[model samples]
Target: MPKMKSVFVCRSCGFESPKWNGRCPNCGEWNTFEEVDALPKSSSSAGKSSARVARSITPLKEVDLSEASEVRYHTGMEELDRVLGGGLVKGSLVLLGGEPGIGKSTLLLQICEHLGKEHTILYVSGEESARQIRLRAERLGVVGDGLYILAESDAQAIADTVSSNKPDIVIIDSIQTMGISEINSAPGSITQVRECTNLFMRLAKSEEIPFFIVGHVNKDGAIAGPKVMEHIVDAVLYFEGDRNLSYRILRAAKNRFGSTNEIGVFDMKDNGLEQVENPSQMLLSGRPTGVSGCCVLCTMEGTRPILAEVQALVTKSGQTSPRRVTTGFDFNRVWMILAVLEKRLGFCYSALDVYVNIIGGLKIQEPAADLPVAMALYSSLTDKPLGDDVIAFGELGLGGEIRSVSHVEQRIAEARRLGFKKCIVPRHAIKSTQKFAGIEVIGVSSLRQAFEAVK
Candidate 1:
């Protein structure tokens, strides 16, 4: 018999070290090393696997793809479908991650009502018991004859049951609580998560069963597991928004079968998650009128155009150093914008405090927001409100020039649909040559010209 040895692994990057350290030498994350015992493999199960082994290689053109014609299972939610490219692909393993109490389980269970209509579903929960799942389903009015629930944590046992039963779809309430007995480390460890995900991935591909697994996030809002676990899955979806707030944004970080840029909006209710079809209207619901430091920004999310309000506040500083606070916007980007305003436009911001926010909790990552951000800062500094029916979308360069943005025609159509009278865009974006009847398109080449035209 061989003596077992314990090794320390970095939870962030899955880097194995003989000893523990405060900071991971691989990923540079502090206090993330965890002790894991290395158990010897059983000799009796040597070279045995439930996964199908390929007997021979075939040409790519010779492979049959007729079965893939109708391989998608729609969850009956348009917003979710849009984010997933079209629908859930067969033999695909999707990882859904979110903060605790952020409706991760609720969204999975809510989709079963529609999927159960034509497919058999096997839902496995490691956190909650069968009775608790039943209680939640009853409250949500999710009654399906083909829905099956299991309250087990053993990954090997669940895999065996799923292989024998071979349900159409499977849902793991969470991957953290699941563990195989072969590993000596406790459940949710780095080793367990990686190995368990491998097992599920193999099972899904070999059996052609789609899997939806819930994952818990860490304090940094990243999925709480080895980074390899995320790379192993076919798709990775993250839930973003405040839990106290009603609206939740579902964004995909990785998707082998779909576009990663797509997003789905949902309104969390007492029953379950209700899809927000027209997110533009939902975001502009409680907009204030005749207010300085406020501007409308039209940003593109995948194929959809969303209107987000950019708000800024410029006030006199009382402390030795001026404060620059921002929410739902990048802190460093805000500083760069302020610097451009001071350098290019000759605005004195050395003794003034600046604050910026995006309404409805939507974070704007696109450069098209630059024009609106600069406009909001100018409005706040001058204490003058622009026209309520005005909107803008153009990237601002370091030289204070308005840069052309993609999808100018789509942005103009959305602004016109929203009843905006004037649309400020980059001069180069005017090359689209598509004239909108109702909306006035104002093209500007420089920052000074944009402000002058707006005034």
Candidate 2:
């Protein structure tokens, strides 16, 4: 028997230390170190020996330079496929991280069901049983003979199963839940996560197997694992949205093979995760007519443009220092916009409690949303509603000047498709577009011009 050692690990960043400390030096997080038993060297050595025997390496120049036809396995969900840059590529490792109950498992199972026909998919769940997965599959109406489920957490066993079955794709329900028998650290610990991820990475690269791993989000909403987990994977995707809403947005934060900024839209249904074909249309549904505090904005999510509603409400505050509350939009940004309105437009909202919300549970992070947010606030303050057919989007400067936004053409096209008859855009955008059919484009250089045109 080999001797067992112990180490201290940071919970926040997965930084490891040989001894305990009050502060984590790597991440600067206080009191995050937790002690865990370390794996015996002999056990890890045995695994390494197996890996070396299983894998063969060749020189870069010695490899054939033939141009092999690219193969894509569709996940049966168009939205997911689009986000993955068409479909899953061979020998790729994708990491999907999100909060609990964010439908990570559901989405992957749905993908398996969709791809089970043409591809042999191995669905390994460390946290759930085969019967539990079958029940969910039944609920999703996805009964396929090609989809195989294994409820196991040991990494060695999983590796053996993958080698024997030769699956086209493999999905680990979660990497954190997987415990390597060779590693003495508990499952979800830093050492275990690092070891398991390394194994999966080697498997994907050596076997030319495309694999997906479901990751959990920490309290700070970041992927819960060692930083190396992200570095080891080919792509890192985040599934984010309010649990209260039916819609969820999947965005690629890091991609080695494709664009990182791409996004995919999905709606959580009772049956399973359903891809939202036209997100703009679904977001604009149930929009109130003739609302004073409402304005339309076109915001870009990755390469796609989505038209969303921005709503603001201003009322007298009973407390000292009027409260500023914002949903889906940054609160500090709202304050900055209010200050700009007071200085440039001569509107004082200091005595009012302002509340802002981006409709449809969509978060607006782009500065282009500033124009519509300001318009909505102004409309509420003055009790005047803008035309229902009007759509506005542009970045607002502190001096009241309108700033140009990226991908203006896509925004305009989305507005046109959604039947928005009038558009208020930056002056710079107007110079670029010669003409757009069936829509009136109003270009403004400053906030005053925008207010006048809408009024």
User: Which predicted model would earn the best lDDT?
Assistant: 1
lDDT of 1 by residue, 205-240 (tens): 889999998888766513346254787889999888
Q: For candidate 2, write residues 1-455 as lDDT tens digits.
A: 55567788776766779989887799786777777666455434435555535566999888875546556677888787777887887889899988889999999988877689888899999989999999999998888658999999998899889988899999999888888896767888766776788788888877989999988876641234535377668888889988998989998877876787678999999998888879989998999999899999999888889999999999999988998999999999999999999999899998999999999888889999999999999999998998899999999999999999999878999999999999999998767547889899999999989999988
Clash numbers, per candidate: 0, 0
- lDDT by candidate, in order shown: 0.87, 0.86
Give me the displacement of residue 377 in model 1, in angstroms: 0.3
TM-score of predicted model 2?
Answer: 0.88
